[model samples]
Target: MTSITATSAAATASTAGKVASPYNNLNETDFLKLLTTQLANQDPTNPVDNTQMLAQLAQFSTLSAQNQTNTNLTTISDQISKLTGVPIKVG
Candidate 1:
C-alpha cells in the first residue's frame, strides 16, 4: 500500500490551480483524499449538494465492497490452489 504524507498531499492539492494528485497512478485512496479536500475547502454558502454527497458515498461504498470481494476471491482461489496442489490463474 502507498503511504499518504502531509507534504505529498498538500503538494498534490496545489498543482497550478489543478487538484494536486499525489499519485503516479490514481487509485481509490487518492480519489478519497481529493474528495475530502474538496469538501473541506468548499464554500459554506455554496456547499456541495446533498445528492452529490450521497452519490459519492454510494460510489465509495461500492468500490470498498468490490475491493473486499476481490480480496476474498483471491484468498479463496489461493486456498483452492493449495488444497488441489495446482496453480490457479487469476485475471
Candidate 2:
C-alpha cells in the first residue's frame, strides 16, 4: 500500500511539475486528469473541501498567468535595456 501510494504521488507530482512552466502548453484534458486524480485519491473520512479545491485550481491558474507575464516583462526589459546602450553590471 505504501509503495502504491508513493507511486501515485510521484506520478501526480511529476504531472504537476511538467505543467508548472508557462510554456509547457497544457490543455483542458491534462487539467481535468489532475483534478480527477485529486478527487479519486482524497480521503473519504476527511475529504477535501470543494472550496479548497477551487482555490487551488485558481491559484494554479494565477501562477501560470503570472509566469507568462513575467516572461514577457523580462523580454521587454531586456529589449529596453539593450536600446538604452547602457551596460547592466552586477556586483
Candidate 2, residue 20: the lDDT equals 64
lDDT of 1 by residue, 11-88 (tens): 976785675545646677777898899999999999999898889879878977998988998999999999999988
* Model 2 C-alpha lDDT per residue in residues 1-91, reported as the tens digit of each score: 3356888988998898666676468765778788999899999999989998899789888877988888887777778779997654422
Question: What RMSD does each model have against the real structure?
Answer: 11.3, 8.7
Q: Which stretches in model 2 have alpha-carbon errors above 4 Å? A: 1-33, 43-47, 87-91
TM-score, cand. 2 vs. native: 0.49
Q: List TM-scores for all candidates, in order.
A: 0.59, 0.49
Name model 1 segments beyond 4 Å from true: 1-33
- The lowest-lDDT stretch of 10 consecutive residues in candidate 1 is 16-25
